[model samples]
Target: MRALIIDDSRAIRMILGKTLRGIGFEVFEAGNGCEALERLQEIGRADLALVDWNMPEMNGYDFVCSVRSKAEHADMRVMMVTTEAEITQMIKALEAGANEYIIKPFSKEAVVEKIQILGLIP
Candidate 1:
């Protein structure tokens, strides 16, 4: 499986990358939404995207909307991984086409369980 992690924080990206790799995913990293879009264009496709809500250039909501607008990425799974912990934010993310939402400070087990629940992992 493949995963794209988009975050402005290098540390968060590194942590998520390591965790996803440990769970048998080939991971790609991007500093922000624009970089993530470029990376996706270059790589062709990703099975999943772990997007951060607050970022430079573009934000996670816009990114999700952009990806959702594309037919080629119709099946791409987007999971919002951020510090935004509000019902409104979560609703917006889901409405914008995110498949899941994981707040910051999440545990590796939590992430794995989410992937499993999404049936991205067997």
Candidate 2:
């Protein structure tokens, strides 16, 4: 599977990339939503995207909306991996087309569980 890790922090991208790679995914990365969009254009499509909420250029919520608006990216799964912990924020993300949401400072197990829940892994 192909996965994209979208975050402003390089360390977070590396960590998520490592985890996804361990799970047999080929990972790509972007520093923020705009960059992620550009990367998506270049890479064609990603099976999954792990998005961070607060980012320069464009935020994760808007990214989810943008992706969902496009027909070609309709089947791509977006998971918000963010620091936003409010129920309202989570709901907003889901309504904006996120498949799942995971709070920051998360364990690898949590991420894996969510991926499995998304049906990305068995």
- Span of ten consecutive residues with least summed lDDT in model 1: 113-122
| Model 2 C-alpha lDDT per residue in residues 9-97, reported as the tens digit of each score | 99999999889999999999999999999999999999999999999999999999999999999999999999999999999999999
Which candidate has the highest lDDT of all? 2
Collision pairs in model 1? none
Candidate lDDT values, in order: 0.94, 0.96
Off by over 4 Å in 1: none
Note each model's CA RMSD in angstroms.
Answer: 0.6, 0.5
Model 2 steric clash pairs: none
Model 1 lDDT per residue over 1-122, tens place: 88999999999999899999999999999988999999999999999999999999999889999999999988888999999999999998999899999998899999999998778998
